[model samples]
Target: MNTPLPLNQIGQFDDEADVVILGYGIAGACAALEARGAGGDVLVVERASGGGGASALSSGIFYIGAGTEVQKAAGYDDTPDNMYRSMIASMGPDQAELIRPYCDGNVEHFRWLEAQGIPFERSYYPEKTVFLMTTHGLMWSGNEKVWPFRDAATPAPRGHQVAMEGDTSGAAAMFALLARCDEAGVRASFDSIAQSLIVDGEGRVCGVTVRQFGQERHYRARRGVIVATGGFGRNEQMLARYFPGLPDTAEPMGIPHTDGSGITMAVAAGGDVRGMDGLIATASIYPPPQLVKGIIVNRLGKRFVAEDAYHGRTASFIMEQPDQRAFLIVDSEIFAYPEIIGANHSLVDGYESIEAMESGLELPPGSLADTLAVYNQQAAQGRDPLFEKHTDWLKPLTDGPWAAFDISFNRSTYYYITLGGLRIGPDARVRRADGGVVAGLYAAGACTAHLSPDGKSYASGMSLGPGSFFGRVAGREAMRGSAAS
Candidate 1:
């Protein structure tokens, strides 16, 4: 457990800085950049040598909106209010307070990233995709064009991918940011592990105890300590304790060492944790987004959610089905082997008739046939009366020999990222159980829970967007405090 060290036990500090940041991922780097840019001495301690958490492993697409230069170049109109509405609709209206500021500060953050030498191509990937390629700049990374979200706000491609090829955008962005951090003169202590916060007699966090190269060293953070050590996806005990009922089929994804030590430290500092049961559970179901034209049915062979919903949303719904069972039924035309995963692993079987498909999958006879009859009927007229999938993706399944991919929550290999951590306000200050601040403690990124409360609400760039933007906010706020008296 990462516990706070009482000042009474600390005789002296071995080192000190105006701000000490744990975790040199994107959030920590951005925090250091801001704090240093504000004329504060910043020291960053990272668990990894190169210092890119789950972010470095991602595709580097950010959910930036309100008409970023990329969006404008792509010729799409966006507004802060619309972006706010769209996010609140998917992320829950209660999250408005947490995410509204990020939406409002979109353009400002984009400019800041640009100022830091990060480049975003002024282009657009017109298709709905799971990941953008090198030339792709903007795409629909969420349910912006899907059923409920479409009616919530005019659809726009908000995923601003870094100007690079392949799935290494996170690496590219991190390299650029780390370079910027160096230019700002931020001191780095890489391959270091923070064991605890150093709290003074007044119960204020004054420093941290970090172990580097087998030596325990105490470093003072005169202003504040920012925790960005990521989530508990890799901490099975935390996952079982905080959010049980996750099927055994789910595997931990994201940073391998993202074990929630920072959250544990924050809890010891009186930080209240919320949304512990929510997480980003995903089963890669797209490369050909047209798969939405298919139907997802429960064990009873009836569609439960709009197939056009975001893959995460659909996955969430599927997990709620009977026996955590569901399948993606696609006619030959729309089925493309699910480009990324679960092709042979989840392919149940193919059948020439709906009745055979049901029997082969062990569902009640005529169930799938009956369900498809209605779906095909409504789809012919280009409408979904039940789920309200967009007309663009509404097409009757007529192409021969249908195939069903086993997207059942229990049968399919589900990958999840932890979404629960220390609860913080828009200011990025760690909040106590009583809704009071944990003095001298600030956090952003996966170590703190704010945006994307659950799998259903997750958008591709939600993590990077809030992590970097609010990270700067956390940095600026941490420096506002006078050195611990």
Candidate 2:
């Protein structure tokens, strides 16, 4: 057996409890509340002063299958089989199953959210209409449904969006959940960093070592620890180790501190890791302000995707260009829409706005004549003659004073780094390399990989949906284990 590292001493310490939840983000907070519900003592640790992980930076959309009472009452018919098939198709081979549970229990989970006083908005779209009727039958044609995945799924007319105070909507809801935890008397500590896991002679984990407020300390989990510290989107070492070759610029997406501490710690405790090769990448054009301005060039210098592809990765299909540093070409049209430049849709919005605000850069201010002139020039020559736009549709900068932002394709501004974390089975229990359960450990949220057989997100609402669903399940299970002991 390998010798375990000695526990490093730190400042003041507290007695370990039945559960030690790492990371105070959405999943961590949600799980802590659920544990409290089950009468288990819980303490949460977070490195950031403020709570909420990438959850705070989301548009908060979710995917629900059709054919349920909601769809049936609206004359829609969606089936679980169809939804599963579509997810499998979109995610490709082995990557799709990780998300299967969300589809199976989507309706119940949504109802559970309502019970928690959370509200959802319906989003209606045309393709969703077509797919709903053909796949689920007579359902509302409201959602952008992947018909191949489910027999019936029309996006809810108002079920797609959630709003919080100011633009801090996600943060507000998350804080509300944190408030619920406080009412339940769940213990929480901020500015704490989990450095390693405590394992016994037989290799089962007992607790963790954390550093907080410039001090290191130990917290034991009489029941078990939940590693909800999130993924390593900003950790270059983990990124290079798993994804290999992802541009260093990908760092602009999520919190810089979420460097997959949970994932690494779990690996140290004998938990098996899976799906390190898979990544959920988002494409962006605008570099954070102050960095060199990037130029979006197709085979030729020009524009391709709609400046508003902020809607989805559909831009990946539209730009049909090779991955050669092809960024986004923008002009006055882009500037007119305030949402395009900030953290409104893609994750890039936050960092982009920070740079623009700090630098006081006017960003070429709006001028239609100058924008079209450049576009028209490129259109006439038909070769990205000046801007290198080769897709054929993006040419003719007959518009004027255009500008370019270089970005990668198949990427988006805001992305959920879902490729890390402990490998768990369908039951959400952490699994050992020998295929055994890791005693009482569990995981949920983006920190854990979704293992979608399809290469894509499969469905929307995945990040929040799974986090909420599995967090509840895992929390309850942990409590039950604690009580049994």
Candidate 3:
């Protein structure tokens, strides 16, 4: 293991607990629940006035499968092997071994969430949209239906949304988790900022130094300390240091407290970090879900990606384009009133025909026309030869009133979050550069690099999926460590 930071010499203990969890988001709440259930006294610290963090800002979708009862009820078949294969193909092979058990036990994990009072309906959201506005329980939140991944794994609607409508489901999920934590007798301190990890003489993390209400306080952890303080999307300096290529003007979709404090603390305690350059960039253009039927083209007016794929995948392809720009081409027939919320869907240019639209976009003579001609021909036959988009989303752009909406990442609608953090093993113990574990340090949630390492592979429910799952793993391990000692 890398050398650990020396113990805090000046600080004296103000309180003590068997397990101390940083941040009261889904991960920290799950960790506290598991640790308390394991008979370890748990103390959860949150920088916010109450519980919810970036997790509550999410859509509350959990990407779980492996023969879940809801999946079976929805007439979808899934298995651990298939889910594992899909995860590897989508999220990359960063920690495949560590992810194996989670994929295998996904159904059990779903039950675990339900036991925590997180409810899920059996219905599936049929629309191909960014997030569900209805209380549907299942949907295809990733590019599982698109090319390559479809052949890699058996496709299923793995995005299980809470039985709550609109964006408030995330808050609902968190409220359930917080309720479970409270019932388990997990104590929490609000508005407490964890400054650093306190290592013992033997280099085991024993506690944390926190700043609460202008006073420096030390909380001793007899078992372990879990860092779930979330990612560093809000920290512009860290963003510059790690993701220099990312534009400074890009909007971050992180909560204000997602400032990488837990990561810095773990690093000081000899923990390793990974996938620091990874981000969950999104370029959604829906809510008026009809816009999904449009075609996305690059600067050369060539259709690059299947417009029906997950918005994150669309964003990844858009960012990969030259100058990181792309446009969504749609016609007035398919256009509806804009959603007025989330991503912008206003048209930049409108035209009566393909030729006029091409000229308006200023593309080379006949380029846009030729592209649209081929797309319309294939779409008329209910086919997508180039990108193999689903037939339900394929439609000819022959109708008049064609328009183009700029869907580039630089726009106000685009939002992203840092996806890199401390590298931990399957046990959720923080690891060193040499792949050795930091004895008493654990991490979960957006604070650790696990699921959805990058935008290219990101799915809707990946954040909370791994956050809550691994939080339980970390909590159990921490309690086990304390019991052995």
lDDT values of the candidates?
A: 0.85, 0.54, 0.84
**Worst 10-residue stretch by lDDT in candidate 3?**
1-10
In model 2, the runs with Cα more than 4 Å from the true position are: 1-13, 65-79, 92-98, 122-159, 165-168, 283-339, 342-418, 451-455, 482-485
Ranking 1 against 2 by TM-score, winner? 1
Off by over 4 Å in 3: 1-5, 8-11, 337-340, 482-485
- Between candidates 2 and 3, name the one with more favorable lDDT: 3
lDDT over C-alpha atoms for residue 280 of model 1: 75
Ranking by lDDT: 1, 3, 2
The candidate that achieves the highest lDDT relative to the unseen native structure: 1
| lDDT for predicted candidate 2 compared with the true structure | 0.54
**Each prediction's TM-score against the native?**
0.97, 0.68, 0.95
Candidate rank order under TM-score: 1, 3, 2
Q: Tens digits of per-residue lDDT for model 1 on 106-156?
A: 989988987888788887888767787665778888889877888999888
Residue 157 lDDT (model 1): 83
Residue 39, candidate 3: C-alpha displacement in angstroms: 0.3
- 40 Cα displacement, candidate 3 (Å): 0.1
